[model samples]
Target chain A: MATVRIVITLKPGVLDAQGQAVHQGLRALGYETVSGVRVGKCIEITVPDQTARDDIDAMCERFLANPLIEEWRIERDQDRDGTGRSRVPVLPRSQGS
Target chain B: MMRFGIVIFPASNCDRDCVHVLRTVLGHDVEEVWHEAGSLDGVDAVVLPGGFAYGDYLRAGAVAARAPVMTAVRAFARAGGPVLGVCNGFQILLEAGLLPGAMLRNDVLRFRCTTVHVRVESTQTPFTRSLRDGQVLRMPIAHGEGNYFAPGAMLAAIEEAGQVVFRYCDAQGRVLPDANPNGSIRNVAGVCNPAGNVVGLMPHPERASEELLGSDDGRLLFESAVMWLETRKRSLVTPLRGSR
Candidate 1:
């Protein structure tokens, strides 16, 4: 089985109210060093075989995310082996930091 | 007689309310159209009432916007049929690309259900023809994702075209930050398409259509649509006053 991962997040300029609440909660818990937090959704889908990149892109663009306010990318575990894992770029640090 | 079609998607809570106001109270011919349907026959106007369609799975109105019925709605609007979307309906309109911009969670991250004062910014659209510019209407807004946002360029363009139909303002029509229930950019509460045939607002006009329920400012919207239809029928030529 091929496992596909889709990560969806709001665009940089769009406001993220839930993420901001999380940031505030972390600060209240004494995590002063953590300056920012932007929560996002990670969806996993298991397909019978390797899913085509075009299909995945369509899924993201059509149903997985709102193109107007969100950005999404897909990750595929093709080999099902640990070594073949794809790396994702980390979110940038908060402006205050 | 003017006929209005109300779309009823799964999990839609305000379909009945819209029907009650449009048919029972306002005495207009109304029909409930299912979301999966492909046609809107014999309808002069269309309404997408507020509700949590598809349980707001991906996003408010995101799933419903792709439903088959919206295809007909889009076509209807493209042909100059007046379309009004309220609350969740507004979100669906944005998702369907029938209108510009998007909706974000409320700035306070809470579900706000309250009567907000909205000032009509334009009387050009079929939906707002009954009200004068700068008229303040008391309407109830009940939603978590009512904060409206658009890119700077899009915002400026809509504002310049006078497509901004309504804005949250004080009793005296003062638009202040504190008066904004949601952090909608520039205190915008509603907007219309450039053609002035389609309008979407994050407030429930149906809920405020009767005085017993509170304010009847919303009734003017329905009356305006009916009047527009009647006027069109009499003239046989659309009396569209201005150009975008």
Candidate 2:
């Protein structure tokens, strides 16, 4: 099973200081195909099935993302047993390269 | 005779200011405690002064918050001791997991250096014993990452719990829309834990402790903390009102 999510950002705050310059360049080139733009960062994580939510949360706070400006969400892979309900599957799923 | 400890780190630049305020203005023998080790041998309260610890190389206060002495500081604060963190110190407190919310780059994307008025929100908390509701004080704020952020539910909960300590304001003490340099939510400049033992702010209160230096309004914060220590640590030191 695979749990998929997307975390997107434009690097850090200072990374986009040239935003205005780029926007102006686009206008001068006759592209006229751009509007307001901002940036952020993105990350993808896979956690263990036995891992507690609190432990994973702590890991996120300490390492995966900068606590100051980064925001993230977690989604667990669900596998159905041919039933009407969905249940989280075991993580670290076996996959072949 | 309350002994206070002013926490010092490699990038802490305001330790002396805190010491001067504690000893000269608030009348306490303030000790400079280093972060490389834990030895708060004789201290009633811990003050984390403002500075760019670790050059804020990572997140502001992220690296310094994990220093050895923070263990003891955390233990002490958890056991109902008072801990005050100003500016970079505030960043440390948040990174140390002592306080909620996080600070990011100022919304305006610039380092702000200016003096602003603030209104004291609560005098009942130990950290605000010397202040009254709506009392205004002018304090200096200098920071690049002072925008405070938390989720909506948590923000409401913090407000409902009376944790707000100060806000950017006009001369009349009304929070000014134009005065919010960082576009901080709700014009918040400072806040305390629900228990009121841990405080964090973006301004330099100790720098305003003396009339000769500049404004003396910030002295009230040191006074309030000292008063709180006297009331809470009666076993360690006898209380004094002004002088004999």
Candidate 3:
């Protein structure tokens, strides 16, 4: 089985109200280094065998994220060892990569 | 007679509200179209009602925008048919590319449900034909993601083209930051396509169409659409000069 990971974030110039609130909260808690913040979502899915990158891209475009305000990037977890090592992110679609 | 079609997607809680407004209050024929259906039948106007379509899962209106019924809705809009998208419907229209710009989370970061004052920015569109410029109306808005955003160039173009239909304003029709319920750029509450056939707004006009419910200003929008359709039909039947 292979694991698929997707990250979704709002496009630039779009307001991130929740992120701003979190940043304010962090600042209120005396985290002086917190300059700015933008909130995003990470989704993970498990699929059998090597799934086509185009299929995942279509899923993201059609259902996973809204292209008008949000953009999504997909990555596969190729190094899922028993030790729970860090997984490297790969670009499923070369969008300005 | 005007026939209105209210699209019903999974988890669309506001479909019946629109149906009631169109059928019971307005005395027009209304149809409840399922999201999976591919045809709109013979409805004169299509309305994308409010509520969390497809449970608003991945993104608000993202899943529902790709439903089979939307294809037909797009086709209808392309042919200059009138389409009104309210609240979640507006977000769906934005995602579907039928309208420009996108809706973002409210700057206050909360689900705001209250009666707001909006001024008629343009009176030429089918949705606002009955209204006059600067006319203040009380309408109800209920949504979490109602902040309208567009790129600078596109925003300027929309303003220049008179596509802005309604703008959040004070009771005296003054545009101010505090009057804006959401953080929409330029306080835009509703906008129409360049051709003025498709309109998308974050307010629940259907919910405000009756006097007993508080305000009936929303009825003017429906009346405007009906008037435009009737005028269009008349013009089609009798073309002015030379053509015949």
Candidate 4:
């Protein structure tokens, strides 16, 4: 099976009120170094290994995200072997770190 | 009397209010249509009322917009049937692509539930045909994500087409920054489709349609719609009779 991750974010000019509120909270917590913040969402779905890229793209365009105010990108991770060790970690650590 | 259909989603709270206003207050026939129903048969007009559908998961109106009944609603709208969506209903219309633009959280980051004045910018739509241009009406708006936003070119096109039906304004009908309650671009409180049959507004006109509820100014909108529908029916019949 292949896992598809879709990340959606508001367009550049659109206001991110929730993100701004979080930025303010970070500043209150002494994170003054933070310049700005923009919030977005990510959805992960598991589909059959034979699912075509075009089908996934269509799903994102039709229902996963709205094109008017938001933009979305898709990332696919295919599990080659029966073991899932090859799957990428949700949050991979920095290479140098 | 013209029959009105009010679509009731899983969490819709305003469907009954609309039915009461149309049936009891205005004395018109009303029907409550479930969201899953695929047919809007035998209704003169349709209304999508307000409330948190699908618990507003994913996004407000995002899930409900894909409900089964929307297909019928789209067909009805395409045929030039009148449709009015209020508050969350307005958000559904946007998400469903029945209307342009999307809503964002209020600039103040709070749910504003209060009364405000809006000026009728255009009287071409069925909902506002009886309202004079520039006439200010008092109504109550209750929502957190009522800020309207559209891309630059799309916004320009909407304005060029004169689709803006109502704009936030002060009591004297002056459009000013201070009068904008939700930070909507151009202070748009309500808008209609290019054909002027579908209208979506952030305000709760049903809540303000009675004097006991503080203002009866909203009643004019329903009255205007009835008058327009009646006139349209007459005109349709006149053409068939081969008379001017």
Candidate 5:
């Protein structure tokens, strides 16, 4: 099975209130070095290995993400070994970690 | 009496409130159209009431925008039928691409539930025909994602078309930052399509349809719709009279 991951984030210049709140919380916890934060969501779908990239792109454009205020990226995990190590982090890491 | 249809999605909670206002308060015929319905048969007007459809998954109104009924709703609007979307309904209209711009989380990062004054910006649409330009109406807004946003060029185009129907304003009818309940750009509270047939607004006019609800200003909108429809019917029947 091939797993396609769609990550959706607000477009630039759009405010991310939840991310701002998280950033404030981090600062309150003494992480003053955290300059910014933006929040987004990820959706993973399992399809046959022969699933075309266009189909996945259509899903993202039609329903998975809104193009007006958001941008999306897709990552494909074509093979899943028994070790289960193909998972990708949905959000980017902050400065320290 | 004109027939009004209120589309009810799975989580829609305000459908009955709209029914009450249209059927009971305004003495009009009302029908409840489920989201899955294939058509809007027999209804003269349409209303998309407020609620967290599909649990507001993905984003507010995202899932519901693709519902089957919207196809019919889109057709209805294209045919020049009046359609009003309130609160979450407004979000769905934006998602469905029937309206311009998108809704973002409130700038204050809070769900605001309060009465606000909105000045009528235009009476050219079916929804605001009974209201005079700059008339202020008190209505309650309850939502977290009511902030309206549009790209710079699109915002300018909307403004140039005079599509804005309502603007958050002070009691004295001044548009100011303090009057903006959700930080909607330009203090816009309601807007119509370019054709002025379909309208979407963040305020819950159904909840304030009577004086007992603290304001009957919302009733004017319903009255305006009815008046528009009546005039339209008369014009169709007497096109050569040239009396309109």
Candidate 6:
């Protein structure tokens, strides 16, 4: 099995009540048009190389993403060559590390 | 004047309580310093009281970190004044860069409150002078964000330097993981800056100062600061001109 790394994060510098905040002006205006406004989060994951993207998606929906509070995206990197042995994925597919 | 100032932002409900303990029990003159005002000119000590500052609107202390008063608080820390940030105040201190790392949500995802055990890990600073190394004290705590986290090396450095002032403990003061209230790393409940002049704790010591209210262990923290000040005051000032 091959190995890869996955990092899930709110979009860059997103207003993460957990990370950043809305520009003060955006909130004071009460743009009721804004409906519900909230920040997001960052989650990092590692997995086996051949693990289908669908399986990863399921993991996120079932556990990582709390539908009521957040939105997220995933990033990936392959263990290509050197030191790949040290970057094994806990998911069993990327076990070299 | 034996003046102490508390940094107050929008939702700091505990500022007055910290002051009450400071004024009534600790017997020191205290004031509520608004974060919008941003100055610690005459305060001998600075306290960051607990409560949901900025409604805990942004990551516990994140929003409050940018408040005007924090600027003064930061300067006060740089000048070596004794600073104590309790509960959310601790979170603010970290967010202001006076301390290290950030606080995260409870691992269990629930608001926790009640009496918890804490062990005095050090007595070197003004706050802990009343405590003995390894002594145990139970203090009441109420908060949603009490987990303390820091990088591995930073944690080790604080320990090696004797800056880790308080640790979560068992009833008898024995520190154990089971006593860890928020699933924090190493059961750490409090710590100080490298200079030892700044201390931050998650427990509400102010709540425990009166025997009628609960335990009296909280009084020591305030008393220790007074003792530290009395001893150091002579060194910092010369005899008054009229006294002679």
Q: What are the interface RMSDs of all the models?
A: 1.1, 4.8, 1.6, 0.9, 0.8, 12.7
Against the true structure, what is each candidate's TM-score? 0.91, 0.76, 0.87, 0.92, 0.92, 0.70
Model 6 regions more than 4 Å off: A1-39, A42-97, B236-244
For model 1, residues B49-91, the per-residue Cα lDDT tens digits are: 9999999988899999999999999999988889999998999
Per DockQ, the best of the predicted structures is: 5
The models' CA-based lDDT, in order, is: 0.89, 0.75, 0.87, 0.88, 0.90, 0.74
Taking the tens digit of each residue's C-alpha lDDT, what string does model 5 give over B81-187? Answer: 89999999999999999999999999998999999999999888888987899999999999999999988999999998898889999999999999999889999
Give the C-alpha lDDT of model 3: 0.87
TM-score of chain B of each: 0.97, 0.92, 0.95, 0.96, 0.96, 0.93
Note the clash tally of each candidate: 0, 6, 0, 0, 0, 10
Q: Which lDDT tens digits does candidate 4 get at residues A14-44?
A: 8999899999999999999999999999998
Candidate 1 colliding pairs: none
Please give the lDDT score at residue B207 for candidate 5: 92
CA-only RMSD, every prediction: 4.1, 8.9, 6.0, 4.0, 3.7, 14.5
* Alpha-carbon runs more than 4 Å astray in model 4: A78-97, B236-244
- Consecutive 10-residue window with the lowest summed lDDT within model 2 chain B: B235-244
Instruction: Judging by TM-score, tell me the better candidate of 2 and 3.
Output: 3
Model 6: residue B75 alpha-carbon error in angstroms: 1.1
Clash-forming residue pairs, model 6: A2-A49, A16-A19, A48-A93, A48-A94, A85-A96, A86-A97, A87-A97, A88-A97, A89-A94, B35-B69
lDDT of 3 by residue, A1-97 (tens): 8878888998886889989989999999999898989999988888876789988888787777777678887767755446444455555676694
Candidate achieving higher TM-score, 2 or 4: 4
Candidate 4 chain A has its poorest 10 consecutive residues by lDDT at A78-87
**Model 4: docking quality category:** medium
| Candidate 5 total steric clashes | 0
The DockQ for candidate 1, computed on C-alphas, is 0.66
Model 2 C-alpha lDDT per residue in residues A6-87, reported as the tens digit of each score: 3434344423423545566778988777785555444445655676657756766785555545655554444334452245
Better of 4 and 6 by TM-score: 4
The two-chain DockQ for each candidate, comma-separated, is 0.66, 0.12, 0.52, 0.72, 0.73, 0.03
